[model samples]
Target: MSQDKTILVVGTYDTKDDELNYMSNCIRGQGGQVLSMDVSVLGDPTAPTDYSKHVVAEEGGSSIEAAIDSGDENTAMQIMAHGASMLALRLYREGKIDGVVVLGGTMGTDLALDVCQALPLGVPKYVVSTVSFSQLLPPERLAADIQMILWAGGLYGLNSVCKSSLSQAAGAVLGAARAVEKPKGDRPLIGMTSFGKTILRYMITLKPALEERGFEVAVFHATGMGGRAFESLAAEGSFACAMDFATQEVGNHIFGGLSAGADRLTNAGATATPQIVAPACYDLVDLVGWKPVPEQMGDKPAHDHNRLLKAVVLSASERRDVALAHAEKLSGAKGPTTFIMPKGGCNEWDRPGADLHDAAGLAAFVSAIEDAMPDNVDYVPLDCHINDAQFCETVLSIFDGWLENGVVKA
Candidate 1:
């Protein structure tokens, strides 16, 4: 028999009472238990909630009276958001809720992001927001696995148009709760990052090879969003080892292109996860293809990946900056660290005769990496392209040594 699934319905119940209750009813109609949390600073819901406004406020280290006394909408909402997020996390930890669905226009959505982020990646976190998919929310504010549904025409009262969104969100969160299969941790898991096989082929060789050594390998795409997910898991100490080979997101973050965040390369180090690092694709930054090219890129050679993304090759000086940034980030690692330098090239596109090949830039990057490498890092330089067989062999050799020395758990 399946376990009973409970979905937490959260909203500003004082203002969105009908909408919140309707969503709760929808979940109940589908045989899912409903736990309502009211995050309202003032006013009262038509019906009492499972977790009330006063409870949420006090849990956040303040009270409803204090929130109202602040006399600023932003301040009051922040207090409520903090409280709601803590309460949501507490509920999940106590096994009182399986999934969470938060409803709101702007204030509610803002709080919802914090609440959802407080939960781990696997638990279903659905946000029914008026600003769903809007650019207003930055990549860092998003939880890696969060699901958002646009609360169309549902800002004020209950209506058929709004009901359509609410009902789907209700069903989605409940269904997700019933179906989620979280990480089992049966085997030591390795988190690796790379782009497409054509761009970065190391994963194609490394993944199966690592699995053969009695490990599970998860490869992230190394795009802005993908890097965020990798960092989130790394911060949680989820990876037995992190083979972070494709690091384009670092360049992206530095150049104000499609960025993960400033914390893109810092999480694994902070968590003391044994990390094997490389500057793969460190010479390029990704920009939105459909938008006007930023002035700084200034006619630099670019590879148009698709209508959605364009890879901009950096100058020799820019590549040097990237190299220094990588070294700086790696210097903070608390666990075992190895820095691999594939001297010939970092990616397939940067090989000789390739479209993005820049011998001078590659040389500059190599020199900078050698100069800035921290004393804590074990630097390994190989005269091979990152896509070459020798690069994969070196990685495995380092990994095997770590295993034998107990730097990494098998």
Candidate 2:
């Protein structure tokens, strides 16, 4: 509904021509500009695309002829997905598009996932997929801010039921682009990760302190999805500095639990985003309500974090393995990095006399980190709990020094 807004409409134009055209018209009727990207690998699109399937394939490093000659649908899909992602990201960075909308059942949604992730945050992304919100989808496959709508009655052809969903998705993406405020220019963004309210006591002190020092702090929760978003953004070089505490997802990843992904702790280092890493909640791994604890971890102390969330304590070996894994990842940092160990305890459940308390396990983690840390990486151990005021002060003090030394911009 905005005159100046531009939306990138993407789909397998060879098959869903009618639906894609209808959606494009709806977007145009709502006063939004459209840039259609056709990801068709088999046949030609019924309607003209601003970026054709062949062009997309070329951008992705393959020729449409090669894809067609091979006669492999999966290979063609992969090529088109990569090309569309490359073109979409180029258009976005060049200011040619402000939002993206893609329609598909399976192939289209897969392609949409690639394109949506290519675009940065604040560029609204919407997906109309028949498989919307299916539990079978992995967290790594879905973009953090993508809005998906179930494509009811949109399996083969467009119908009245399908039109209803299509019309709403068209309007919502345009509306979001118009309503979302443009970020103020070039301010340094600091990313901080936190667990839930259990650790909110000390986490609340961070934003204000960082803001006072003239940095914008974005705090992401340490849930599986939250960790994915944080690391994804970090990999994109979205932050001037990073504080990756609440690292339960790292342990969860190693143990095949509710992990962000296997690559969670590796991005900030890869991107060289000056980061301070901590082992917050590294003593616990998450389990879903519907699933029973794995037999290997059944004997560990467990607690219900909420109705659908379960937290299981890890053994000393588990903690040591987690710490070693993290040390291996941090050792690869190309930028300034610090690993802070809170000696008193890492989590609320790990404090003295708590149900999950294990001093030996905590000690194992610290010892592993100390032994495996690379020479360039700073390992700072504090004699305080993770949530202690002293730990908070120590974190801020280290960050401040980085600021003064120009390791991070304020």
Candidate 3:
């Protein structure tokens, strides 16, 4: 009974009133405040909510009558989703809500995603859903920091099993709200992308170096979900600069591999954020290791990084296609961009006589990048491999120049 935080309880209160109220009581029991938002389109809650369905629908730019007249459940829910998300954002901005806990099945979960995404990163977003970890939830649909607990056995009515999930979710959201230390924007932030240190070692050196120079460095893994989070921050204009070094997600998007969506490398450019780019692992596409290799990739050399991931080395032609894709994405940059081409090799595994080395493939990729280099991007071709000391120094040199020229503010 020590915490004093407000938690937003969102759901189709018309049907799930009892369950929602149970969660609200749990929060109150923990010394937390509750604000209820009803998103039901057809029925009313037994008691009036702080924000009624009519208020939610109107906030989304439509009326309840228009939603009923539409006669389409999907359309009606979309209207509610838009309204609820906007209202949730407004509540957060006004400092009225500290965290959000949303309850639903598939339809409710769909609306929950929108509402969670409307809030900024670091605001606690918890979802209690029947399809909590199901494939129905794609990486792109999720907010960067969303948490979900499976709504077990609570679909029809509240049971002991489901009560466990609801109570835990209630405590977790309230606890997170009390303990969270949100970004203070104290230092200029740099968003960088790379794999683990075994494959991409630039972050090991660059992070401390950037910190010494008064910049906060956040390095994101280039896997599907990691890249999605990086792009989300970039789109928010959260980073002063983007060091997008590990761009394997671009090749992954091209070759039916694990992807960060079609917009993997374009967010910073779209927001006019200065970006320094390198294709650290441009020669491979990552696929889930347990899945059967696609017939087209069956003949390619593969590396099992772990039980979770497998990397397929692209052929020379495929490497060229990826290089051109990078160029195409960079060509539309609205701000300053620099693409560094490491002529020796792009990744450690592709270096001289390494297990994954393919000199011809590297040559093709380098040539494609040079030939397709856009006018706006300053293309610098270096003699060292991407993991070499010289490559890291070059990056620092460019960043230092930017700082001096006021392109990157400290």
Candidate 2 least-lDDT 10 residues? 195-204
**lDDT comparing candidate 1 with the true structure:** 0.92
lDDT of each: 0.92, 0.87, 0.94
* Tens digits of per-residue lDDT for model 2, 90-189: 9999999999999988888888899888887778999999999887567887787889999999898888999999999999998898887765646788
Give the root-mean-square deviation of each candidate in angstroms: 1.4, 1.7, 1.1
TM-score of each: 0.97, 0.95, 0.98
Give the lowest summed-lDDT range of ten residues in model 3. Answer: 133-142
Candidate 1 ranges with C-alpha deviation above 4 Å: 1-3
Residue 56 Cα positional deviation in candidate 2, in Å, after optimal superposition: 1.7
Better of 1 and 2 by TM-score: 1
Sorting all predicted structures by TM-score, with the top scorer first, yields 3, 1, 2
The best candidate in terms of lDDT: 3
Clashing pairs in 1: none
